[model samples]
Target: MLRTAAAAILGVTVLASASMAQDYRLNPIYQTISLRGGFTPDPYVINLQSGGNNDASRTLGGSCRGWVATAPDVRLHFQAGSLPLIISANSSTDTTLVVNGPDGRWYCNDDGGNGLNPSLRWNSPMSGQYDIWIGTYGSSRNANAQLHISELYSQ
Candidate 1:
């Protein structure tokens, strides 16, 4: 009887360990293109016509807008490519960038040059379509920038 009880307890421990393990896998690739015309008048620009020197770090120094889709319990991988063009923003107000989602409402805010980048990662809290809005404004106006993006869906 003692031996049988010990064996039963060992089996239960093994089963519990297996159930507690977490599994992470790569999801399929989803991608799209986004652009901002240099000639268009952007309300987010702080200095419309001021052509200032381009920052070498090229880090987003001003506010810009964009969106991403969301789904309950879903993780997404965002990859961005190099941008060769010059982009700028004004100093008066934060640049306005809007991110539109399918189920959820739009997300708009001033990003003091924090949005410009090679890539970004986002997770979905509610499943639905999403879009990113780029606000053009500030002394960074007329500055050109280009970037390619890739998204990997993961659960």
Candidate 2:
């Protein structure tokens, strides 16, 4: 009887250990934002809109009409930490959004002609601040854009 009880206790301990190990694995966290542009050059700053550290910064993806004569860009200011692995965007026009990281830049192209949902993945560097931009050569008047962010880390 004593040996049987010990064996049962050991089995229960092994099962509990396996369950704890699985529970400790990191899970991905996601955040989303919606942007609406006006007739005027209403550059939506993701950091400002999301309220700073709570959200990431954003820039024009590439060059717009007269504003931001260069590629549309979005600037982000981080808290000097690693970022998520996945970033996505959706718009009503063929647009490209680029994420400028501390190490390099990764881009997501949207060529749906009308608009599309696009996503890009990359390893973000640790930084105090970062910038991301989106834009197209043609004119996108009063366009709507959506941004999605996914972060994965072990607590």
Candidate 3:
């Protein structure tokens, strides 16, 4: 069940359902990332906070104007290759991960890593913008999550 949630992620053009989707962004907006092969640059971690509407009536950030809560989007340009991305929250019960890439495809992850952490590798990633959505499973709890992103490919 978990394996397919991300694989079947809706395309970027697809609007979220009635439950509402999140709009995330990095606290410090970094446009482009520099990377060399075989080098894991220091992971930039951001605190995840979500706000919006479940009815799809409210939009938070620019990327989520028609969507829901605040899900951080890191506008990045990397070398054309597979970029290994690691996104983790405080715990598995806290959050899920969804990414919208330059190709206009959505990549999602639900509890992929140990203790609900989500990780994915974008193969043949185009050099452009990316929408990184941190979705909270349990809305009753505060939106407390940490995102760790690393550029795994070098040009």
State which candidate has the highest lDDT.
3
Candidate 1 has its poorest 10 consecutive residues by lDDT at: 11-20
Error of 1 at 3 (Å): 53
**Model 2 — which ten-residue stretch has the worst lDDT?**
48-57
How much does candidate 1 score in TM-score? 0.27
Candidate 1 residue 16 Cα shift, in angstroms, is 44
Top of the candidates by TM-score: 3
For model 2, residues 14-55, the per-residue Cα lDDT tens digits are 011111111112221122223221111222223211111111
lDDT of 3 at 142: 42
Candidate 3 lDDT over 49-131, as tens digits, reads 53223312232221222222443434444444444444333443445555566665555555554455555454334566666
Between candidates 2 and 3, name the one with more favorable lDDT: 3
Candidate 3 regions off by >4 Å?
A: 1-40, 50-52, 55-74, 80-83, 87-93, 151-155
Kindly report which residue stretches of model 1 are placed more than 4 angstroms away from their true locations once superposed.
1-95, 112-125, 138-142, 146-155
- Give me the displacement of residue 33 in model 1, in angstroms: 5.7
lDDT of each: 0.26, 0.30, 0.43
Clash counts for all predictions:
36, 29, 11
